[model samples]
Target chain A: MSQNRWAQQTLWGWGRYPRVESLVARPERRKEVLDALADRQGDPVLAFGLGRCYGDAALLREGRVVLTRRLDRMLAFDPETGWLRCEAGVSLEEILHTFVPRGFFPPVVPGTQFVTVGGAIACDIHGKNHHVDGSFADHIRRVELLVADGRVVTCGPDEEPELFWATVGGMGLTGLILSCELQLARIDNPYIEMESIRVENLEQFFEVSAESGHFTHTVSWLDCVTTGKATGRGIFMRGRHAPAGTTGGLSLLSRLGRAAPALINFPVDGPDWMLNQATIKAFNEVYFRKHPKGQVNSIVHYEPFFFPLDAVRNWNRMYGNRGFLQYQFVVPPDPSHKAIRLVLEEITRSGLGSFLAVIKEFGERQHGGISFPAPGPMIALDFGIAGQPLFDLLDRLDRIVLDAGGRIYLGKDSRVPRHVFEQMFPELPKWKAVRDAWDPGHVFQSELGRRLGLSGGQR
Target chain B: MSVLILGATSRIAHELAHRYAENGQSVFVAARDADEAARVAADVGVRTEGTCASGRFDATDFAGHAAFLDSVRETVGPIEVAILAFGDMGDQHASEGDFEAARHVIDVNYTAAVSICELLAASMTERAAGSIVGIASVAGDRGRQSNYIYGSAKGAFALYLQGLRNRLFKSGVHVMTVKLGFVDTRMTYGLKTGIPIAAPDAVSRAIFDAQRGRSDVFYYPHFWRGIMSVVKAIPEAAFKRLSL
Candidate 1:
C-alpha cells in the first residue's frame, strides 16, 4: 500500500476555476482504493468522481485525490425492488443508458447526466423534478463510506442518522463515499409529455411557475440579456413521463424510433471574447421568438428534455482556459419575488447579460446541514470572468441575496468568499461535529473544504 | 444464443458480456479470480435479467483450459460467441533482464489465448457455427523498445487470429481480431500518452458490431488503422533510431 505511486497532476472543477496541483491516484478496484488511502499518510485525501462539481468540491490542493472513475462497477441490484447497489464512480449517464430503455430510471437527475452518484450525493443535487420528487440523495437507501480510520461504515437515514445526514452534503469532508444503494424509479416509458410556454417578464415567470407546480418537472430559461419591459422574459418548460399506451406525439407503432441527431462538440476551447453581451442578447432574442406565445404540447424523448447540454460534449470548453463562473444562488420564496427582480435589475444596470440563465423552483427542503435546495427558486447564470469587475458584480449580487435571506449554491460557486459561505451555511458547525467524530484528523478534506473553513485544525 | 467472455472481470469483457446478455443471450463469465467473475456475472444478470453464470478459469493454466471450457459448455449450452479479452502486460524492464518473466508474458498473451481459441475453434468447426473475437492491441502493430516483449506477444496473437479466421471461414465460423487502441482500462490506467484513449464500453460496442458484421479485422477506434499503417510503413532502421 505504501509503495503505491501517486502521480502529480493539475485538476480543476467543472467551471475550470482555481486549478489545483495535487497528487492523484486512480484505483480500479477496492484493494487499490485502500492502497491509495493507506499511502495518504497524514495528507488530506478526497475521492474524485467525474469531477462534475462546478466548484472546487472535488479538488484537493497539494493533497491526494483518489480518482474514482476507474472504480466504476455495478455490484448488485434487485429487479423487483428496483434497488441498485453500485460503486460510487458509476455515472448517472451510464445508469440511464443501461436502465432507461429497460423501463427503469433514476428518481432524480441533475441538468447533466455526466455526474457520478457520489458527486450527486456530495452536493445533494436537485433537478427539475426537485419541486416534486426532491433531491437525488432522497432516493438513496444506504451508502458504503470509507472513513478516515480505514473502516467501511454502512449508514442510512435510519441506521446512523447523524453520519448519514452529515455525509449527505458534507462535500467529501466526512470520508470517501465508496458505493451506494439507489432506488430506481419505475417509469411508464422513455418519453416525456412536455410543454413549452413562452414567458414574458419576471412577474409572469413567477406566476406561470407557481401555476405549473403540478407538473413533475419544471424549469425556465431566463434571458438575462433582456432589459426594460421584458426584464426577465424566457421560456418556461414543464413535463411528466408519458403515460402507458398513449403516444402524445410519436406514432404508436414507431415508439422510440426517432433518430438522434449527430452530437456536436466544441472540439476545443473557443476564444474568450466569443460570447459578448451583444451576441448573447441576439441569441436570446432568436431563442425566445422560436417558441410560441402560448403553450405547445408534445411528446419528447427523456434525453432532450432532461439533458439538453449533454448532447454537446465538451460544452464547458466553450468557456476557454481562463474559465468562467456559474453564479447560482437561491432566494427563499417571497410572494413579491423581490430578490429575483433585484438581481436581474442589477445585471441589467451593469450592462451585462449571462450566456446561460436557468430558473428552477425547489420544493420541500430535506434537512441536511449544507444542502443547497430549500423550498425556493434558484437561478443560475454563466458569467465570463472579467477579473475584478466580475467579482465586484458577484459581491454586490451576494449582498442583495443575503439581504433577501438567500444563499448561493456552493456546489456551483468557485469564488464565493469564506465569510459569505459561513453566513450562508450557519449549520456548518453541526455538520463539522459529525465530520470531526468520523475524521478527527481531517483525513478527508478538499480545496472547497479548506477554502470555506469547513473543518477544524487549519494547520 | 450463448456467449462466453474470458477475463470477465476486465472492463471490456464485462461490457461485452453485458451486451450479449442484454440481447437475450445466455452469458457465461470466466476469469482467473472466481469470486470476481461471479460478482461480474451477478451484476450483468440483474441488468439484463438473462441466464448468466460464472466460473473460475485461468488463462495461464495450460492443462486446465479444457476442463474450464467444458464446465462453461455444460452450464450455458453451445457458445455462439466467445471473446478472448485477457492479456498480461508484464513489466518490460524486468522481462528484459529475466527470461522467465518474458516467457510468462508471452505465455499469457499468446500461448494461453491460442490454447483457448483452438479448443473453441474445434467445437465450432464441428457445429459449423460461432463468432470468435480476440481483443489484441495496437501495441502489437509495431514493437517499441519500451514495451517490445508485450508487443511482440500481442503481435503473435493477432497473427494467430488471422490464420484461425482463415481456417474457420470454411466452417462458417466468423473470427474477429480487434487491434484495440489506448483503452481506458487497467492496462492503460496511468500511462501518459497524447493519443485519445477509447472507453471500454465503446470498444466493446465496436467488437460486438464487428463480430455481427463478420468483419475480419478492424481497429476499435477505426482511426488506429491509419496510425498503425504509418507505424508499419516506417523503415526498421529509422524506427529503431527514433525509439518511440
Candidate 2:
C-alpha cells in the first residue's frame, strides 16, 4: 500500500521556541510506519512521538517528522508481573489511567505525564525516585526498533544490546521505535505519605536529602533569588507509597479534589518584562513564608506530589511569548555542593532568578551509552527567553558544568555548542558508532542531532 | 455485532467505524484506497478487542457490489449493520457543461448507492434482521442554482431510501436515511460554503444514536431537519428566483 503524503507544518517543542517548518506524516498503522521508513526519498525523517521534549530533540527543520501519536495501542499486559507491551505512542498518563486503579504504575515517570513511551526512552527521563529506581530505560525490558533498512529488530540488554542501549537515549536519531515492553511497578495505593521540610540554604538541603535516602522519592524546590546567608532557601520533600487499606485512597472524589479546580491557563503571553526578577523575587518570598518552619507530614494524592505544575493547563505561557529555556545539568557527586553553589551564585549575581528551580539526586548510571543521569545532584532552572544576555549566562554555566565533570540533558536543551555537547557526553562517539552500524545512511536525523554534530556527518 | 462500513475512508465513515470499534464491535472497512482502508482497519483493530478487516471497494464499480458483499460476509461474518457512506459531489459548473461529469455524480450518489442497497436489503431480508443506513445530504431537500446537479443526485438517493425503508419495514430490517449538512471533510476542503461546519465525530455520534433508535429518516445535527423543512416549504417560483 502506498503511504500517505506528508503535510508541511510549522512545528515547535513544548518550549515553543525556535520554531521550524517541516514535512510531517501521521502514519496510523505499523505497516505505514514501516513503509514510510522503507521508501524514504526525502530528507531524513525523525519519528516524533509527542511534542513533549521541551527542546529541538524531536524537531526536524525542513525535514520529515513522522508523527507516532496515532500508532498508540496497548498490545498486551501481564497482571501478575505488571509487565506491559504497548506501541511507542502511548503516553505515560494513559498507562496510569488504565493501570493505577489495578495497583500498577510505570516504574519511572517524568514531571509531566504527557510524555510518550518512545520519548521517555529517547530522553531516558528520570523521576524524583531517581536516587532509587534510576531512569526510565532501567525498567524497559525490550524494544522493537525499525531501523534504516526497513527491518524490525527486537533489542534488549542481551539481544542486540549495543543497538538497544544506543537507541535508549539516542533521541530518535538511531531509528524509529515501533513499540516496547515495559516492567511496571505495583503500587499498594494511589496516595503518597509525603513529608515537607523547610530548609534555609543549600547546606541544609544536602543534610535533609542525605537523611531521605530510605524514602522512595525525594526532591527540592529552591528559591533562586535569595543570596548571601540564604543561598538556596527552599522546601525539600520526600515521599513513599501509601500502604493499601489506607484511610484515604485515590477514589474518584479524592482525585478530583486533589486536581486543581477548573484549570486556568495564561490565555496569552504577557509582556516580556512581566516575569522579571522583581516579580519572581516577590513570588518566592511569599512562597517561602507560606510553608511552616518545622517538618509537615501528610497523606496526599500522587498527582499534586508528582506533577504540581501540571495543575495549570498552560503554565509555560507564564514565561511569555518568547517562551522559556530550561537549563538542566548534573554535576558529579564529588564537589557537588561547591559546583551547585557556584551555579546558583552566577544566577543570583545576574539578578535573573528563575521562578521554578528544582533539585534532585540521581542514582547509579544505566547501560544506555548516551543516558544523562549519573551519581550526582541534578538541577533544573527555567529562564524566560529575554535576549542574548540569557544565552550568555547559560554559556558561562555550561563551562562550570563541563569543568565539574557534568553533562546537560539533551531532552531539555535547545542551544548548546557542539564542542561542549561532545565534552559533556563522552559516550557520543560510541553511540554514534552503534547508530551508524544500524543506519549507515543516517535516515533518522533530527535538528538536535545536527546541532550536536551527531547526525552521522550529514551536517 | 459486526458493522460493514462502505467507503470507510471518508472522514465521517471512518469516525463512525472508530466509534463502533471502540465499543467492541467487529468492523470491516471497505474503500477504494487500499492503503487508507488497511490503516483504518489496523487502527480500529488495536482500539478494540474485537476483530477488524479491510477490502477494496470501488463504489462506481456496479458489477462488483454483489461480490464485495459476499466477500465481506465470508470474511467478517454476517453484517448486522451496513452503512452506505460513499458519494461524490461533482463540480456543479462543470456538470452543467459536461454530460459525463453530471452522469458520474448521479451514478456515484444515486445509482451506485441503489445497487449496494438492493444487495444488502436482500441479504438482510433473508436474515430477518439488520439495519441499512444511507447517508444522503441536506442539499437534497430543495435544489438551488448553485449546486442543483449534486442536490438532484442526493434527492434521488433520498427517494430510493424512502422506498427501501417501506419495502423492508415488514421484513424486520431497518433502513435509515441520514441527511447531512455542511460536514467538515476533505470532500469540502477548499469550498467556502458560508455555514457553520459540523465535526465528523459529532455527526457520527448522531448517526449511532439514530441507528440504535431505528430512526427511519433523520437529519444529522438534528437542527438541519428544521432548516431543510423551511427550505422545502418555499414555493418553487420564489425558490428558483432566489440564489441560495
| Number of the top-ranking candidate, with TM-score as the measure | 1
Q: Give one digit per residue, the lDDT tens place, for model 2 in B124-223.
A: 9999999999999998888888888999999999999999999999999999999998776655433456677888889999999899899999887778
Looking at model 1 chain B, which ten-residue stretch has the lowest summed lDDT?
Answer: B42-51
Return the DockQ of model 1: 0.39
lDDT of 2 by residue, A1-459 (tens): 445557777788888887888877777666778877765675788988768878888898877888887667676777789888888998998888777877888899888888899999988889999989988989998999998888899999889999998988889988899899999999988888999999998889888988899998999999989999899889999999889876554444335544754445556776788889999999999999999997999888777878776666667777778988799999898744878988999998887879899998887765547788888889999998878888988999999999998999889899989999899887888988988888888788888888887884536
Q: Which pairs clash (backbone N, Cα, C closer than 3 Å) in model 1?
A: none
Minimal lDDT window, size 10, model 1 chain A: A252-261
> What i-RMS does each candidate reach, in Å?
2.2, 5.3
Please give me the DockQ of candidate 2 compared with the native complex: 0.17
Q: Please, what are the lDDT tens digits per residue for candidate 1 over residues B96-163?
A: 99999999999999999999999999999999999998989999999899999999999999999999
Q: Give the clash total for candidate 2.
A: 0
Highest DockQ: give the candidate number: 1
Off by over 4 Å in 2: A1-3, A38-40, A247-263, A456-459, B1-80, B83-129, B134-162, B170-172, B177-204, B215-244
Can you give the lDDT of residue B48 in candidate 2? 49
